[model samples]
Target: MSILITGANRGIGHALSRAWQSSGTEVIQTARNSPGMEPLDVADPSSIKELAERLEGQPISTLVCNAGVSLDKFDELETGYAPELWAESFAVNVTGVFLVIQALLPNLRASRDAGIAPKIAIIASQMGSQNSPAGNRFIYRASKAAAINLGRNLAVDLESDGIAVGIYHPGWVATDMGGDSADLTLDEAVPGLRKQIDELTLSETGCFKSWDGSDCEF
Candidate 1:
């Protein structure tokens, strides 16, 4: 099987790439400004088009939209969460995910044509959950909520094409974005995430799940 992962230079993306590689799956790793990998800036339409063109006849069984930014992590409630930060966050976190999937629709169809159910795994966050209330990181939270909504809608739209779309919370791993104090290591999270993707099917499309395979509030 083949997989395409965005932002695979580091964090969970990188870990997932390495894990898939070790299992002998063909993995296409893309990142912004990363050498020896596909140069893709999900926020840039031209870049997404270029990558799509480059991978033109290749079948992508799974597309993991893992590229995201947390620009408002330290923004204060009273004085921060600047307007520009909101734009930047949505540009990459929400819009970028949609753009990549939109550009790669043909490639995903290639997998479906081969009798494989193409899967879209969106790396959303628990922060996006309306059921959970939190403070700070307003921009990140809102963008991720938009991402979840995007995945849900895509699940509906893409189901006829035999594609499954799932939104996932990768858990608070000790990545730069998650901070050193976060629970779960890459080792713990990657396997669970892989399982969630591996088991995703047309029947389960639009499901919001935690890395450990539990359902998450949409």
Candidate 2:
């Protein structure tokens, strides 16, 4: 089976790609500017279109929307989280995910036509959960909230076409974004994430899950 992963140059995405490759899965990795990565700027419509055109007839078994930014991590509550940051965050974290899926919808359909279940795995966060109460980094939280919502809606809308969408929290891994104090390592997270992605099905299209297959709130 073939898989397409965004932001696969580093962090959980990189780990996931390596794991998939090691398992003999055909993996198509994309990044905006990373060395040796196929050019794909998810925030740019033109770039997304170009990539879509380049992979025109290729059937994508899974599309993992892992390209995201955490611009609000350093923003302070009293004097940060600026207006521009909000736009930038949503542009990459939310809109980018939608645009990639929209541009490659046909490829996903091709996978279904080939009798390979087409799936969309969105790397969202528990930070987006309304059930959990947190204070700072409003932009990241809100954008992630939007992402999970988008994944849920896309799952419903695309179900008739046999596309399955699942949103996930990859866990707090020790990556640049997750930081050194994170709860998991890149090694610890990739396996469960791959399992979650592999098991995605039409019956559970809108499911929100953790990397370990537990249900995620909201």
Please state every model's RMSD to the true fold in angstroms.
0.7, 0.8
Question: What lDDT does each candidate get?
Answer: 0.94, 0.94
Give the alpha carbon lDDT tens digit for every residue of 24-119 in model 2: 999999999888777999989999999999999999989999999999887888899889999889999999999999999999999999999899
Tens digits of per-residue lDDT, candidate 1, 128-176, equal: 9989977778898899999999999999999989999999999999998
Could you tell me the TM-score of candidate 2? 0.98
TM-score each candidate. 0.98, 0.98
Cα shift from native, residue 190, model 2 (Å): 1.2
Q: In model 2, where is the ten-residue run with the lowest total lDDT?
A: 129-138
Output candidate 1 Cα RMSD: 0.7
